[model samples]
Target: MPVPPPLRQRILITGASAGLGREMARAWAARGRDLALCARRPDALERLRDELLAATPSAVVSLHVVDVADHEAVDAAVDDAAAALGGLDRVVVNAGVAGGDSLGLDGAEANRTTARTNFLGAVHQAESALRVFRPAGAGHLVFISSMSALRGMGGAMNVYSATKAGVSALAEGLRSDLVGTGIAVTAVHPGYVRTEMASHFPRMLMASDPDRATRAIVAAVEREPARAYVPALPWAALAWPMRLMPLGLYRRVAG
Candidate 1:
């Protein structure tokens, strides 16, 4: 019998322009895997593609300008990237926004935008990924959640936390639905990575740089765990207590 072909890993990552997503693209490409990179910033995407190719001339990096909030655009971009990559081996739903309202504030628009991007946007990606994987009988669905998703967060983090919680639940549902199927689903909860999104913070809590976080993420992803905490240090250990902390204490600590 003819030998089966080697596994092809054409990974698709959203929000690949900057932050953790950009690091993931660079890290994955360094391993000689072809990548499908998408982000809202076309210029940044092109620059990243150039950087990746320059580092490893043999790597395949396809760029797409995409706004994850646009469901139709997400579908189209994913389809085009999968086609270019000869079918996707993995889809990382990494695009997300951290802004939202504080209670008793007029930030409804901010919360809505966050909801549309973090929750609905992720839903669209999952649906698109399933379409590509179901027939092919294989694919990895990676959801980028946050440590804040462990419980309802406060203030500006409220909606962001809620959205991540939604995605985490979505990942679990997908896992249950896809059991015994070739398609695998994983949820990664990353804590305080040093990214532009958190640049304005007075100080990050247990912050790790993007490169280190990406290393842990890539490792966890390769193992295809149902759930993982990137860098798996204080965050994994901290999650339990953080969830169980009384509201008053939590508020004081968070404040």
Candidate 2:
């Protein structure tokens, strides 16, 4: 029989201070998974750590404050997490931003910020995570992309969708390159989930609750699939239609 991959005991998640990241930490902690939570806020991280420890005293929860856009800082934080956890079995590149405006309508800085945080930040996290995974010869890397990645979006979602598309592509490339290696990559494409991130967005139709969304995403990650459309109901069924929709109608609904 083929040997199965080891249980991913130690998990490192970026953007873990709040929203989906925080909820994912809680879910994994309940499962007795040791976690390294990385974010820009120390207080939030500490609060989450305390909450997890209170709920599951045996779970080891580490914290690291980091800005994912800075490759050097990502390197340091990821390395630090690995060291603290005695080596990382999994890394979830979940940190990202959703701020953007229409091209020409807004300054380049707005779009640039989104690009740096969403796309480049993912690149940095993947690079740093691989440094440890490659040496260890085993690891699971998960990327939290979006349903927006299925097709081009309009208005503020344009840049965000593009960034997610890049992330999905990155995950696919890694999966291809690491075919023979024990390392695994999973791309999670989530539709609008009720969270602070979605609150900032308008026109979120049939959005799933935070708990439901977290469950779907965590379940998909555990499966270590090449790509997953989370919640599987509407998002999975909607992917093809979204891709095949007429541009005029797409723009109307997407906007």
Candidate 3:
């Protein structure tokens, strides 16, 4: 059952320059929430903050130039954003890179970058958010894992898949750690959202528009579930059965 979500929240979203992160900022701002936007692209963040402020006069929009891969920087950014927003009620760890070639193709550097950005970067964000939430005893942490996390993927997806699985694990582990605590966490597994992340792919299964995907994700995040498959539909129904598929068949189907 879905419970009533906190309205007019103070949200800090990493990677708010484009794609799902950008759309989520818009969705939250439309609801008149305070936003702390962070991304490597400072110019883009400023534009988005301006747009949000223009659209909703009452919305409190702030920008933080951040690179999530830098642990110390991420920690500082989260603290700064929390202070700017008067304490964060929710933090969305949404920054990630889909860059990586096949492990077989000697793509070690690419694989390393992917792992660093996705897993280590997320660790910094989650830790920082928990610091804010622990004292508040009432906060939500949202991680944007992927449906690819259901199983290990090969080709260029090898590193990406493993990193997402780690992210999901973090959410699951946090659920156990926060038992009896008021803080909440959710891992959102979205299937092929039509953002820059999936734009290069030639064939995408159950592809979803960015706006539509953001709305669904925001809804699930607000509900504060331990885990959720976004744009539920076919994705939610298929999650379990897909996980049960044999590796050989999954590789073929995935490719």
Report, for every candidate in turn, its global Cα lDDT versus the true structure: 0.90, 0.92, 0.90
lDDT (tens digit, per residue) of candidate 2 on 1-255: 999976649999999999899999999999889999999999999999999999999899999999999999999999899899899999999999888787888647878999999999999999999999998899999999999988888788889999999999999999999998899999999999888977878689779998999999999998888999989998999989999999999888877
What's the CA error at residue 73 for candidate 1, in Å?
Answer: 0.8
Top candidate (lDDT): 2
Give the local distance difference test score of model 1.
0.90
Residue lDDT tens for model 1, 25-127 = 9999999889999999999999999999999999999988888888889889989998899889999999988776676798788889999999999999999
Q: Which residue pairs in candidate 2 collide?
A: none
Model 1, TM vs. native: 0.95
Better of 2 and 3 by lDDT: 2
How do all models score by TM-score? 0.95, 0.96, 0.95
Q: Which segments of candidate 2 are over 4 A away from where they belong?
A: 1-8
Candidate 1 regions with alpha-carbon error over 4 angstroms: 1-5, 201-203
Which 10 successive residues of model 3 have the least lDDT summed? 197-206
Q: 240, model 2: CA deviation in Å?
A: 1.3
Candidate 3: list runs displaced more than 4 Å: 1-7
